[model samples]
Every structure is written in C-alpha cells, then in structure tokens.
Target: MLNKYPLWKNILILVVLAIGFVYALPNVFPDDYAVQITGARSGTEISQQTVDRASEALEEAGIAIKGIDREERSALIRVTSSDDQLEARPIVQQALGEEFLVALNMAESTPEWLQAAGAGPMKLGLDLRGGVHFLLEVDMETAVEQRLEATSSQIKRELREERIRYLGGDLSDGNNIELSFRSEGDRSEAFDIIRDRYDEFLLDESTEGENYLLNLSLSEQEIQQIQDYAIEQNLTTIRNRVNELGVAEPLVQRQGADRIIVELPGVQDTAQAKRVLGATANLEFRLAARQDAPRASTESYPFRDEPERTARLEREVIVTGENVSNANQGFDENGMPQVNITMDGVGGDLMTRATRNAVGRGMAVLFIEFRTEMEQEVVDGQVITREERVEETSIISLATIQSTLGSSFRITGLDSIHEASELALLLRAGALAAPMYFVQERTIGPSLGQQNIDAGFMSVVVGFILVLVFMAVFYRAFGLVANVALTLNLMLLLACMSIISATLTLPGIAGIVLTVGMAVDANVLIFERIREELREGVSPQLAINAGYSRAFVSIVDANITTFLVAIILFAMGSGPVKGFAVTLSIGILTSLFTALVVSRAMVNAIYGGRKVESLSIGGKLANV
Candidate 1:
C-alpha cells in the first residue's frame, strides 16, 4: 500500500492526460497555403462578384487554387502550393483593386469538431512560418521637431488669447522656439505665460537691441519623455497596422533607443507588409484662409484629387488624426464615397469651439504623408547613401461648416471608393507619431520555412529517440516507465503551448530537446535513488516510495531554478530568445509533472503493494 495511489488520484491523472491529448491534437493538421481577401474598411462585405473576380484572376494566371470560401466579411482562396499563394495574392489584389486587401496567409485546416472545442494549433514564429522581418529606424529628430512645432503653435494661440502681440515665433536650431516681440512688455508677458503654463519648457528672455527675444526650450527630462512617447506611440501604431494586415503571431517591439523590430509570421507578401508598416499618413483639420489673411499665417497645399489646383488654409489646426476615435467608409446621399468620422470627447469640444464662430467658413482636411528617400552624399570623401524623410501635404477635402460640427461628422470629396476606404482604414487605425524607415528587411519563403520545420522536427525526433534508448538501457523497467512518462510530458507540453497560442521557433525546438534530456535526468536520479535504497536492504515497495519521495524535492528545486531563468530570458530577450524561453518555461512545468507524478504512478502500478525483492533496474544494483 506504500506506493499505491488513490482511485481519485489515478482518475485525475488519466483526465489530465486526456485533456492534454485533446488540446494537442490540432497540431497534426497542417495549415493550408491560402490568400485571404477582406474589405479595406469595415462594413464592406464579400460579395459573389468579388469571389468570381478573384477566381478569374487566379485561373487566368494558371495558378491552381484549391477552393474558395466566402465568409460574412472576408474570403479565403486556398492555393495548391506556396508559389501559388505568393503569386495569387497580387493577382487578386490587382483584380479586386484597393477596395479590398489581399494578404498571403495560412488558412486553418483543423477539423470542425476540434475547432468547435476551441482547439488551435500552436503558432509558428516567423523563422518557421516564412514571413517578413523588418528593422525600422525611427526619425527621433523629426519627432522632437514635430513636438516643438506643436508647442510653438500652442504658444502662438496662448499669446493671441492673452492679447499679447509677438512679431513671430519660429523653431530655431531644431531644439527650441524663438519668439521676437516689438516691446519688452510683450516678451516679458509671453515668457511668464509660457513658464507658468508649460512647466516642461525652459524659458529665457533676452534684449536684442530694440527687439525683445523670448526662447523656449524643452528640459532634458521633457525631451526624454517626448522621445519615449514617440517610440511607444510608433510601436502601438505599427501593432495596429499589423493587426489590420491580419497577421498571426506578429512581433512589434522596440529594438533600441530609436528603432523597432517587426516580425509578421505567416505573411508572405513583404510588399504589402512594408506598405502598411511604413505608412505615415495623418489628417489635419484647419479653417480655410480668409481673403485678407496674412501669407505668413496661411499655408497652401495642392488638392489630392485635383493637384493642379491649390487651397490655402490657416496654419492653426482645429484637430488632428490623433483625435479620431473611429472612422467608417460609406456613400453619401449623392452616391459618392465618403468617410464618417467620430472624434473623442476632447476633439469634439475643440471642433465645436472652432466651428461655432465660423459656421459658414470652409474647413480643409489636410493629408500629410512622410516618405523616405535615399540620397547620396559625399562624407569624408566617401559617397554615403542616406535616407531623407520627405513631407508631402495635400488637401483631401474642403467643405463649408455644415451648421456646427461635433464628435461625429462626415467628410466628402474623396476621389473614389477605394481612396475613401483606404483613408478610413488609416484614420481608424490612428496615425504614427513619427515617420519610420526600414533599415533592414528579411523575407523568409515558405519553402525555407518548411526546411527549418523539417530540420527542427528531425532534431527533436533524434534527440527523443536517443533519450529513450539511454533511459531504457540504463534502468530497464523503471526506465521504460520514464519513457512512457516522457512521451506524456511532450504531449502535455505541446498542449500547454497550443492552449496559450505560443509561437514556436527553431530555438524553441531546441528548448524542447533540452527538456527531453532534463526529463530523462530526473528519471535517472529517481532510478539511482531506488537502487541505493535497495542496496540498503529496503523492500521494493518502500524503495520505490522513498526514491520518488526523496527525488521530488531535487526535481522541484532544479526545475524551479530553470523556470526562473526562463522567466528572466523571456523578460529581457527579444523574439527568438523569448520564444525559446517560453517553451523552456512550459517544458519545465510539464516535465516536473511527468517526472515526479506520472512516472511515480506508473512505477507504483508496476511494482507497488506486491512482495518483491528487486526492481528491474539493470546492473548488479537491482539484484538485491
């Protein structure tokens, strides 16, 4: 009775193993290489016409598509191979146009029953799924300058509200704003206003002959905060874009002081990925310039639809894309495409104040875009190619203030439905705080990913077999029980990962291999302990119980330490290392359960409660 487990205990073990097997079953069903097509904006449905167009495009290209399935909002076109998947996406995109987003993805092929129970396959990392990895360098200087410009605009507004007239204020030396006033009183008042209201800025006043100068520069702490905010905002914006792309297990994290890393696993179309990730389009609402407005206070931009024509708008912004809470694309009463915009509470108040006094005045929506271009410059006699950020502004819409606008309003004048949809998508996802350029990009094809999968699988299989052989030969019957528990350990590990949707990379597979060895070591320790107990002239049942009872502490201690290390790695490491750490952490837990509990149960069933002299642990040590 010493080594015997209670009925409920055995039942609980069986139930756990059953659940593990159920959850881990989905991984056996591989995903289908497919192209997913969805509306660029919400409320657009997948119609039969769209499906026909996609099918026709694939057929004309001679790319064999397995089938087409249309859901309520999207359609999936399963292809025969990865080549077809890659080639079919562009063809479909060209056929469907910009109104629809055609993305290369892996379609789930799990059985309906398993899917119904919420069982999903473990997500593969970019290295295993063949996607795009991008290293983007953010323009931190541009971010700071943008902040300064906003601060300058706020200061100008504040001075005007206080009836303090300043000649002009300009962002000087890219670090601070310098204001020139005609009188010392105006400069002194402005300095006090800025210093009192904006604690982040360092205000200094100087007398330049007759002109009074007031300079406002951000404090070091404030600058650092701005930089941190820019990076955090960019990461969030990039994540939103990646989600819109419908990527699975995408990685978007800060790389360093001024860089970001994005890994889009299961996304084969790098062009689409790059376009979405690097897009820096934002919207600005400004009142149209009056006929007598000063040139210095107004800026001109060409129309997005009619570039030959230009419109001038006030330099002050009423609200920006950051205020947009939601946007949806729809058709106006005139049957032309339009975007319905919703603003946050703060934005709504600002819009109401800006529109209340200028009911009939026209307001222009400015679309600002930042693009990165390569320029060659001779630096130290070497021609170095550098990326230059170019800013382009265009007026997308100009309409009279229809009564008084509020949190919810509609913008018309979009050229096409596709343009309207794209604009709505951009606005809905929010805007990037600053422009980012891709400094490095790596594309992994599905074939290469398959190769990695094959290699990883082979390594696991080989390592597993070797561990099994060593365990079986060294300890005979107890080793066989360990092997059975080892198999269950793997199942439980996979189940845990799948349940949590963990991304498995090549290094993660390495962790699994390491887990196998550690599991075997645990069993080896217990078997050796049993051998020692038998040498001390203990009975088989007592030796078995003592071996397990004594080994539990060591197993728990060792696994706990390893689990701690894995937690630290996951916390401090990036994509690959994190993937490895996640698996190792999970494996440590599953291995502990199997090595101590499952193997003990099996050993108890094999040798417990009966009159036995020795365990079938090989060598003279077992001959007690």
Candidate 2:
C-alpha cells in the first residue's frame, strides 16, 4: 500500500513538537529560587532616643528601614538602600555610629523571573556572595605553655585530694620541690612516700648532691601529639560555626599540621565573619572579688583607674563558650536584643553550682575582648607613644547581675539595630575559631555583569546568522529544509538548558556556535547523496530514501564520539569549563535528532510515493 502525507502537515507537527518542548521549560526550573530575608542583630547599650534619631536620619537620606531585630549588645536594622555607593556607605556608617555601632549586611536582590521560570535555586560563589575566608596559623608556643600550666594544676589537685603532706617547692611554679625531712632517716621515708604517687608523670631522675632531681620535660613525640590535638580541636570548632551559618556548601579543611583554610561563599559581612572566626571560645567562670577584701588587694587587681597604671582590672570569665550547646538571637522582656544560650549537661551542672553560690553577691560580668587600632600622641617628650595605630583590646559588655550564672542565659549590649543582628547571627552560627583571617577580598558590580551578558548575546546572534546564511545560499531548497531543522535544533537546545537550569557562560556561547556548524554537515551529506542518485537516473523518492538511509550511519557515528568527549570534559571540569561542556553536549544531541529525524520526515512527506522529474538541491549540486 502506498501511504501519502501532505508536506504542510509534517511541518505543522514539527512546529507543535518544538512549541510543546518550549512550553515544558518552566517545569525544569527550581521552585525555591528566591533569596531569603535572613534575620538581624540587636543590643541593650543603645538608647531608644539614639535609635529614633538614627531612624530619622536614615529616612531623611531616603533609606528605608525594612525591619528591626534587637539583641543584648546591639540592634539589627534591615535597610533598603544602595549597597555600592562610596558616599552612601560612609554616610550610613557615620549616622549610625554617632549613637551606636553598626554593621551592614547586604545581599543581591532576587531576580524576578526566578519564580516564574521555576529554575533551580541559585548557588552564589564566594566572590559574588561576600563572606569571610580565614587562614589560621596555630601558635605552638602558646599550646605548650597551656599544657605546662594544666600539668601543674593537675598535680596540685591530685595531691590535695590525697591529703599528702610533704614539704617541697611548689609544683605550680614548675620549680624543684625539696621535702622537709625531720632527719636523714625521715628524708628516705618521705622520698618513698611520694615516689609511687608520681610514677606515671615522672621523667628520668638522678641524685644531685643532697637532693633527687626529677625531670618533667615532655618528649618530642608528646609535643607533636599535643599540637595535632590542638589543630583537630580548632578544625572542629570552625566546622561547627560554619554549619550554623546555614550556608549550602562551605569549604573547611586543614592546610597543614598547624594551619586551616575556611571558605564561606555567601557571607554578606566580612567583619562579622572575622569576629566569629577570630573568637577564641576560651570561656572561664571566675568568682567576683569579695567586698571584704583589703584596699591593698583591690589596688593589685589589674584594672585600676590610676593615671600611672597601664593595667586595668581583668574581669574574669565565670563560664566559657566551649560548654554552650546552642545559641539563638531573640528579644528580652523589654524587647531588647539578647542572645539566648544553652549549655551542655556537664556545663549546666557547673553553672548551676556557680550561680547558686554567687546569687546574692555582685553579678558575674561577661568580658569579651576584641583587637582594634587607636592612635595616641606621646604623653611626654621622653615617652615614645603612638604615631601609627597599634592593636588594642576593648571590653564589649557590663551587664548587671539580674540572675545567677546558670545552664541558660542571655547576653545583651547591642548599640544599634545592625550590631545586634550580626551578633545574634554569629552566635547562632557558632563562634568561629581563631587563626582564620582574610588575606584577600573583592566585589563585582551588577552593572559589569549586565554588560558581559549583553556582549555574549551579540556574539551568539552574529555567529548564528552567519551559519544560517551560508547554509541557505549553498544548498537552495534542500538547504531551506536544513535551516528549518537547524532552527528547531537550537530551540530544543534552549529548552533543555532552561529545563536543567544550567548557568550559561561566555564559553558556552562558543559551544553553541560550533553546534550550528556541525548541524548543517548532516544535511549536506544527505543532499549530496541524493544528487548523485538523481544523476544516475533514479526516481526522486527512491534517491531521497537511499540518501537518508546511507547517510544516517555516518551522522550518528560522528555525533556519538563528540557527545562522549563533551561528557568527559564536563566530568573533569569546574566552573565555566563545565558550563561549556554542558551546552556543547546538548547541542550535539539536539542537532542529530533534528537533522536526521526531522529533515528526513519532511522530505519523505513532500515527495510521497510519486516520481518527480526535477529536484532542486538548492544551488549547484557542487554547493551541496
């Protein structure tokens, strides 16, 4: 039976298929592609009057305060303003700082098409997202000193618990302890009494004249072990904090034995990141000075108001940050910003005991120290005081004792909306470990990104038009069919890209250009075969069928090899290179299907089972 179909009918079917694919495009994009409005910082130190004044100033400058969240030590104000103006940043900073410390958190606005397009969620890189990166160098000397102090404390605690009474130098000072013996016989008895007790920690010992000298030096292997443990501990602390940031993919790894590298891709404020990362997390709970202590004792306390004194009273920490299990930003009873914190089981027990004992006494103060630069002139001609600013430590809080130090508590001293917000975020994110500091920073303007997009579009348009012209001019009517197939091929490619939500880079445009050239090659092969068959006196229908069937194998083989190469490139590539590979692979697949299936279907329908006398292969047969 001879089956026939109209040429227009086949063309209509092809057009419908292309439109259907394009319509399905939005389904492939992600649903939750918009940027989220993450919460802000707060504090108690800031007066309400100052906040109102700052708000008025911002309004006067045309900046809108979108939202406000308060914390113990600061306030977080979500503001709508231009992020890139050099003049705007300083104006905002000065206006806010006049009454409170402010930290700005800025992120790119969400694209409007994100929801409509249903594209996958956008993942921002470190460069575009602005966050903190740190390379921490561990202080081995400090670690060694800490170990020595711990060893001494342990020895004293054990002796006191055992009720041992032997006169010797103090272990706390790392000096020789000479036992006071009643006689030579008592000396031998005292030596035997402590020998077995100190066996585990004792190093090599020898008699030095009238006393036995016991060495306590740690071995090289022990020191190395201590260093390794410190590095691991630091890494663990950093990982915990980064995880708390709610970031999608953060890079945290050990660079070497004593260093670590941390990368936070979408962090908006580098200063806050630095604060979190630079915190030592070394928490301590210390008893406040007794009111009955002598005036002489008070004078010796490091913090003194004396003009001649350089040292000040060092506010001792009662509980350290290590015991904290969770931290969150929240409002206190009066709507002030405060960081709510919970401690682990052991820490809870210790805190409970400490608070119970100190409940009626002076409140335990939380002291937070951070390094900053300050300029000072020589007070006297003889003294060499500051020209270039140097690092100085400043206290962050002086909260009144309202409740006992316990398992749960809040820290509040927020001066402005922004300061409070950042601290809350940092605490929730986890206090970052020390040694991580920024080495480089950069920011890209959106204008530049837009310009790149425009240039890329023009290049692709020019290249595609040139390919379309060459194909149509060289192959006449047959070339027109090829061009239609080529157009469909590009449409399908775009549909697939939209479906996958792949980011298109400049190199990806080049891949698309290459695909256009390759798509025409398949049609040229089939057309030349048809011309050859026609010259030999075969009917147009038979020549077309023979041409398609013979050319199919070669076209499939060539495309399959190229497809494999693209896949390999994608697997091994990163960033833009992977983008190029993805577009190129999509192009190869779409071109093959359109050039073979689509073009052949159209030609078959046009000729049907009837024989034609003349068939145009576009221009000259050689042009094919």
Candidate 3:
C-alpha cells in the first residue's frame, strides 16, 4: 500500500503535525512573575521604608519575599509560591496599599527545562476572569463635521494664498457659505473652481441665490464605511498600546457598525484601565486670562455665556496633544508625585513662546471633564441658569511647571497616587475619542474561576472515559486502536492550542467533545470498509489499504465542510463563539491526522507483513 501511493502523501501529514507541535511547544513551560507595589493614598509616595514594611508584612503572612527594589514612587518585589499557594490580592493590597499591581506566571520566569518546553499557567477568557471591557461608539457625526471644517479651512487658505477676490462667508456652520464674486462671471467661475477642485471633499452642492451651499453630510453607506475604518485603526492603536504595557492575550476587535469592544482579563485596576481607554489626550495650549482682566467679581458665574464680556477676551490655542512626544509619572519640586511630559520640536517651540508671553500672568488652567450621560443631563438642565457651572478646573503652579514640564506640561493635583499614575498612563496611551462611562460592570473572583476549572476538567475526564469504554465494547480491537488514537489526538490538540495562545472557554470544550465523536466516525467508516474487504477474502494489507482509500474522500469532504462553518463563525462571532470556532478548527485538523495517519500507523505496526485468516475479535466478526 505504501509503495502504491505518492511518498508526499504521508510526508504532508508529518509536516502538518510537526508544525502544530512546534507552534504549541511554548505552552508547556512555566513563566517568570513580578509584583509592583505603590502607595494607594493621596500625597503618599513609595520609599525604601515602604518597601521594607511591605516585605515585613509579606513575611509575616508566610510569604518569603526574595528581592525588593524601591524606585522614586514604587517598588518591585520578587517571590515564589507553590502552584496551590498563589498570592492573594487582599494580603498584597493590605501590605503594599491598594495601588499595587501583581503580574504572575510570566513565561520567562519558568525554569530552563520548563521554559524551553512551553509549559505555563492556563490562559483564561475575559468572561471567566473579570477585567475591563469597553464598547466605544465612533462619533461619525463629529468626524463628518470635522471633515467639513477642514475642507472649509483648506479653501480659505488656498484662496488667500492665491489672492482670490471674494467676499467672506460663514464656513463654520457647514450648511451654508456665501462668496460674493467681483462680477457675475467671477461668481460662476469661483463656483466651478471649488466644485471641480474639491470634489472629493464635497458631499453635495447646490446654488441658492448668489451663494453655493455645500451639503457636507456623508451618506449612510459612507458613514458606515468610515466607522469601520476608524474602528480598525483604533483597534490597531489600542493593540499597540496594550502590547507596550506587556499584557497577554488582550482582545481588541470591532463589535458592530460603529462600536469596538476591548477586553483585558486579569486587569484589576478598573480606574487605570478606564484612564487608558478613555483618554482622548486632545491637549491644547490656550492663552491664560490676563492679570489685568476684570475678575468675575463673584465666586460663581451665570450658566449662560455673557457674550459681550466673554468674547472680548483674547484667546488662542498654540499647540495640541498631537505634538506631545512622551509622558510618564514623576515628582514635582516639592517631592509630590506628578506627570512628566515632553513635546516634539514644533510643540516645544510653541510651548516656549506661550510660556514666555504668560510668565508674569496667571498660569494656564487645565480643564478635564469626564462627561457621562448623567453629567450631560445635569449640565443641560442648568444651561439657562449656570452654563459655566459645567466646567471643572485644576490649576498647576509655576514651580510645578518648571519641574514637571520640560517642553511639555504635567497635570497634577491628582487626588491619589493611583489617580496620578492613571493620568500618566492615559497620556501615554494616546487620546481616546471621548471619555467612556461604565454602563455595566462585573468582577469574578479567582475562587470562582478555580471552581469552574474543576467542573470543566471533571466533565472532560468523565466524557473521555465513557467514550473510550463505549468504543472498545462496540468495535473490539478496532475500537481499542481508535481510542488510543483519540487520546493522543486530544493531547496534541491541547498542546497546539497552548502554543498559539488560543483561549479555552466552556464552549471550546464542547467543540473538543464534538470532534472526538467525529473522529470515531472516521475510524468506524474505514474499519467497516476493511471488514467488508476481509469478508471478500482479501489479504490484510490489501484490505486495510482499500478501506483507507475508499473512506479518505468521505472523511475529507465532511470535515472540510465543518471547517468552513467554523471559519465563518470565527469571522462573525464574538467571545464564546470565537473560542468555539478556534477549538473546532483545531480539533478538525487533529482529528483528520489521528483518524487517518496515527491509527493507520498503529495498525501497520501490529499486523504489517503478517498473514491473517480473519480481522476480527471475539468471533463476532468485530462490528467494525
């Protein structure tokens, strides 16, 4: 039989299995781990004393702290624990303060043998281990408005540069623009110029009286496309930022037409996660109110803007967050924790100019508003009486400016160390579209996760035993061979999943069970064919070869269709559906190998080059 087919036939199976195992080898190892500790309360900083205290506390709790290092505002501690004695959050938080972050089971921490073998802790899905999940809706309306504004600005700039004679028009409103030409012919020519030159920018256009109204509204289909593109871009940016934070298996993907879902499992600091996910770091450097400017004369101002007074003040933004180079947590001159920021070349020049002009005057105030639905309602209700009340203000000092701002600005006055750190992280993560409010939240304790793991393992064990027993009793010798192959197939599948960092959920386990049954079906098909050939008085080798050849096409066709369905599910599904698809796809591939190649190899080893009167056991003609 081996001599009859192409040598590449067996080699293809070998290569695939080799690739899968090679990819999976890394999942079999242990990992290195570290713990970061910091002060939780406001105005508190981590020092050597803090580190010493934490070490003592851990030691008292029967946890042996091996090495400890204290930086300016935080500490890094290293320790080891048995698999059953993993560190608990309460004990660590009580000792190191609520700001402490612990990272355990790192791949690099495993022993050399285990590390090389790709063994480590099991990966948990977001549903099992509570973390942060974000559903961000892209503001397509705002995007279109911005595009219109940009188009208007470009037109103004180009006309000015070209010295075109035209009347000024209101471009900010987007719906209408008036440009009185020098003559009727010039008006027509100007309209043609804009309509032809800026076709891509214009959504729709019409002439009303002497003005051309460019309808800047995007179509529904166009808006949907833009939303998708934005979601993809945001996903890439978020993925990169999360990777920089050294997180493992962070899932970032588009959830719907305009929303994206980000899941970060094992992220305990909800505040920190929110900061990273919500910051739209749209920094702006506007001139401060001058010292000689008239004061409000009272602590509170009316909600409605006093246009006569407010519009008289001169204000302009010199730069924005786009010019920022980097931001990090640091300390002010008074030894208070602050965010250290740096700017790029253009931003540094702009900042220097702005600072030089405002040195003797009041410092620039930073406005940070976390707008949620409730906040919006409150602001809107007071719009007629106290519109200004909606704005929140925090002031930084010249000393803080000098220490923390170097071609950049630090936003201080944070209520706590965690808050300050989170602010820094937000700046570092880049700006978000807008502040996100929690619509729903949930947390799963590690204890519950452990319980779930135990239940899932028990189910798999029981199912495996039942299937093995059933196969052996029903098909006799052939059943025994199939069962062994099935067992090995499971090990290989798990090894492959771990290697690829594919998550395993409960639904994924169901996929594995289904694959098991399907694998048996394939073997049953081949075995029954071989039995038929044997009853026709064919030799053992010829019967086996004919059976496999006849059943191969059917097994391939069935599994291929299933594989296609799994792929479709992966493309359109989320969360558990995705996990199910991943496991199903992997299982199908493994089943094909185990049912065809592995079982065949075992049979060849047992009955190769041997004459047999009958391929049956227990004299029942071996129900195949």
Candidate 4:
C-alpha cells in the first residue's frame, strides 16, 4: 500500500499536472504595448485598407512595428515598446479621425495559437490593474417619483377606459395622487374602479375646500419593496452597461442601501465609460402633434438632443425602450444611421394597436433623460438650497409612418453614426430603475498597478522562500519532497484560476500566501504522525504507511471545515473579500491533493523499494 501509485494513477496525475503547467505558462510572458482601433460608428467596417493606412502612419512616425492582427471586432497594432505606443496612438487617431476610436491596449507576448486555445492569463481586478472607481448614490427620492408617475399614467388609462370622467390626477403632498371629481357620484365610481383593478394604492376620500378629492397612495410595504427593487434593478442594469463597454472585468455591486460601487479594470478612456455608465437615457415612440403648440420652459418638456426646442408630445407613451429586447446600430435604406429594434410581446401588441389607425401620421422617436438640477429659494427671509429631478424629453426624429409596424421597427434621424451607435448601446443596456449620482470618483493609473504587482510579487517570494527553508531544515529529505509538492500546488492553483478565468485581486494574493501555510501544515501533520510511530519502535516502512493512513482522515476533516467557510464567505462577501475566498478555496483543494496524493507518490517512488531505513528528517536511525 506504501507503493500504491499504479501505472494508471501515475499517468492520470502526470497528465493533469502537465495540463496545468501548460496553461500556467502564459504568465511568464509580459504584456506588449499595442493600440486597438474599432469602428466608431455603424456600417463603418475596417478592412485591409484601414490596417494598411494604420501601418503606414506608424511607419511614418518612425515607430517599430511588432505585428498587426485583425480581430473580429477591432484591429490591433502591436508596437515595439511603450515609447512606440505613445508615438503610434496619436498618429493612428489622426488617420482614423472621428470615424474610428483608437485606444491604447496591451497585447500578450504569448504565441497567438496558445491564446486561441482559450488559455490566457487570469484577469486582474481593478486594484491590481488600476483603473476607474466610481461610488454611485442611488436617488431614492427620484425612484419614488418615477413610480408615482407610472402610477399616475395607469390611473388615467383605467379612468378613460371605464368612461368615468374626472379631472386629471396630480402628485400632491409628496407621495399621494389626488384625483378631483366634479360630482360625488363620479368620485365614488372612480373609487370602485381603482379598488377593483389596483391594490397597490391605498385610497382615501377627502374634500379639498369644496371639490371632492380621492387621495391615492402606495402602502408602506409596497413603497419599500419598490425602492429595494429599484436598487437591485439598477445594479443589474449597470452591470450590463459595464459589459457593453468591453471592459474585461468590472465590479458592479450594491453598496449600503442606496449606493453602488463600480470598478473598471484596465480602462483608459474614462470619458467613454462615463457616457455609457452615467447616462440615464431612454427611448419613447410617440405620435407627434402636427399643430404647433406654445412652448413653456418651466413646466413644458423639451426634445431629447435638441435642448433649445420644445416638444408638445402626448402624455401617453406608445411604447418605451424597456420593451425593446434587442437593438443594433445599422443603416437605413438611404444609408442614414439608425437603430434596428426588436420588441418584446407586450411592446409589439402596444405598437400594433397604436399604429393600426394612425398610418400616414407622424411618429416621433423621443429621447428622454432623467436629470437632477439644483435651485436656491428664499423662504421666510432665509435662503434654502433644493435639488429637483427633471424629466427631460426631446424628439430625436419625426418620421411619417409608412405602415402599421409591430414587433420590429427602425428609428432614424440620428445626426451621425456615432450617435446611432451610442443610442443603440443605451437602449440595449436597459433603463435604470432609479436615478443615480456620483458620490466618489477615482482613477488608478497603470504605473500604480505595476507597483502593486511588484510589491505583491516580492511578498509572495519572500514568504515562499522562508517556508521552503524552514521545511528543508526541519524535515530534511521529506522536507525536500514537501517543497516539490508545494511548488506544484501553486502551479496547479494558478492553472486552475486561469482555466476558470478568475479575477486576481490583492486579497487573492493573500489567499495564495494562506495556501502556502496550509500546504506545509498538511505535511507537518503526516511527519509528526510518523515521528510518533517511530517513538514506539515501529519499523520504518510500517511507520511510513501508518503515518499516511492515520493522518489522512485528520487532514480531510480540517480542510473540509475550512472549505465550507470559504464557500460561505464567497456567497455573502463582495469584491476583494470574495476574491480572497476564491483563492483560499482553490488553495485548500490543491493542498489536499498535493499532501495526500502528490507528496506520497513522490516519497514512495524514491525510498519504497530500497532497504528500509530511518527518514533523513532526524539524521541517524536503523531499519527494523
């Protein structure tokens, strides 16, 4: 049993280790300075000509070229060094102009084939890579207001459908909807209608001086639920937005009750990030009023992109961007930039009913932005500052409906291809449930990230060397075997992380250090068990066999408990805490394998068939 690693077992172990070793090799290669050029607008495809143009521009600038690769979405130009990268970026941007977005990127030094096999280095987290960090505070007040507006629309629809005449409802007293009825009979009728159809609102009857008023407000529980949903939905929406930005690893999670923290790694263009992540924009398809209406800047709404003009749009929304399941930037029949939209079943039904009788009428694509503005007012001889959320709307495009469209449609009137792409991206990312403002913003540069890497690497090396030396001095030959196992365990951990594409943060590094201790601890348990057996005057071979068998259960139990804790931490923790839990979990797993399977296999292979003798651990002892 001491020499139990048969041909098949040995073969399996070798195969796994070899695979791990191969996958972990990419880390040895350094990143190269490169520039990536992607199409800035729809229908602006990059061909060989663009690549050639980029090459010529860089060559003219006297920059050394490493290679040029055409990717599915973008073209990459690899440069010789960082200096060459600095020289090539501006020149390429100039050649491409506004039609293409040129950004600094890092290409791996590993061969392309290895990368093609889906084996690349693990992604580094924001702390390790040093990018953008934003702490966003969700506007709870705006969330409630938005919900109230939605409720108001629903009430109007129901009242009109039931043929109950009433004055339009208004949001009064901060959170309640006050609906005025000229007659008591109509007020009672409306009460029954709302009570039967809507349980979300708590109704109250009151008299506003002389007019009959029905007060409608959401219950406390409903309001709290809506607020919670708003934060959760915004978290999901922000995650989608971050992904659309092509950031490799972004951290978007809820913080406290009404806040979110977003970390974007390896991002250089903060402006673009802000545009895609910060904008609270949506699309609305509405029927345009042909007659010109008087414009009021204070109470009236303005057009989306055109701020100077006003849009007298109907309050009833035909359909919203929320119903859009998919959107892509493309070109129309006349080569105009447009977004091809596909709607969900609900949206499709709404559109069909809306346009059935409205053919030949004008349909306007209105852009809406939920913005917050601050105003100062004097009350009772004292001035107080107030912040107000403005629902800004604009008619981006007004087109005559050619036919009754349902399910799918195209929106035109985008001024540029860039605008089309951006609008499409926003629609596809979905609308935020609540408005948010930046509470804190930070940017970490690549230089700082490199410094963190250097410092972290040095710490690991120092810790590993000290452990390696301690094991060697204490356990001698067996210590050497433990060291070999420790080294392989690390390689396996990294290989596993690369295979899973785990994000390695600073806390993850601490996990690796924790793994080093656990690996050595396992060996120490077995070695101590063997010493106890030897003190009883057992034969060396018997002691060795007993040492492993007796210690195996203990190792499994201890590691199992720790593994369970890691799972809990990972499930509940966020950001760097989760990162640490991930590496620690992987470490516990690999340590068990190395201590029980790997180290034993190596030890038995070396001294199993030879004359039985004492372990080199304690110097001189004879065989039984």
Q: Per-residue lDDT for 109 in model 1?
A: 88
Model 3 spans > 4 angstroms off: 1-52, 61-88, 97-110, 117-122, 135-261, 269-272, 283-431, 435-441, 616-624
- C-alpha TM-scores of all predictions: 0.77, 0.51, 0.60, 0.76
| Leading candidate by TM-score | 1
Residue clash pairs of candidate 4: 302-393, 303-393, 303-394, 304-394
How well is each residue in 1-624 modelled by candidate 2, as lDDT tens digits? Answer: 132446676777678565636444443442211111121222236555555655666678776666554444444555543342322345545665533334434432324464454533334334433345667666665566455544544444344455553334233333233333234454444445456655434444445466544445555767677678777777887777666556534667788677777766555454545555555434333444565664442222222112243222223334455567777777778887766778788668766765675665543223233333435566656655442312223333334556667678766665544455545554444432232333334433333343555576687788878877877887777788888888878777776775665545567777878888889888888898888887777776677877888999998999999999999999987655676798899899889888888887766666657656666675333211
Cα lDDT tens digits for candidate 3, 533-624: 77777776777888888999999999999999999999999778888899899999989989988888767666665665556422234222
Steric overlap count per candidate:
0, 57, 20, 4
Model 2 spans > 4 angstroms off: 1-84, 91-140, 143-269, 275-624
TM-score (C-alpha, index-matched) for candidate 2: 0.51
Q: Per-residue lDDT tens digits of candidate 4, residues 1-624?
A: 555567898888899899888888887776776788887633356788888899998888888889888964478898877667767889999987888877766676777777887778877888776678888888888789778877787678678878888865888876789999888898999999899988988999988766789999888888898899989988888898888887765789888999999988877545456668877666677876545533321123465556687755566677777788888999988999998989999889988878988899878777776655678999999999786767666777777889999999888878878778888888788878877876677877555676788898898999999999999998888899999999999999998898987888899999999999999999999988888888888878887888889999999999999999999999999878888999999999999999999998888888776667677765445357
**488: Cα error in model 1, Å:** 1.0
Q: Alpha-carbon error at 186 in model 4, in Å?
A: 4.3
Off by over 4 Å in 1: 36-47, 53-63, 71-74, 83-103, 166-188, 191-259, 269-276, 283-313, 319-367, 372-431, 609-614, 620-624
How well is each residue in 549-583 modelled by candidate 1, as lDDT tens digits? 99889988988899999999999997799999999
Candidate 3 differs from the real structure by a C-alpha RMSD in angstroms, to one decimal, of 10.4
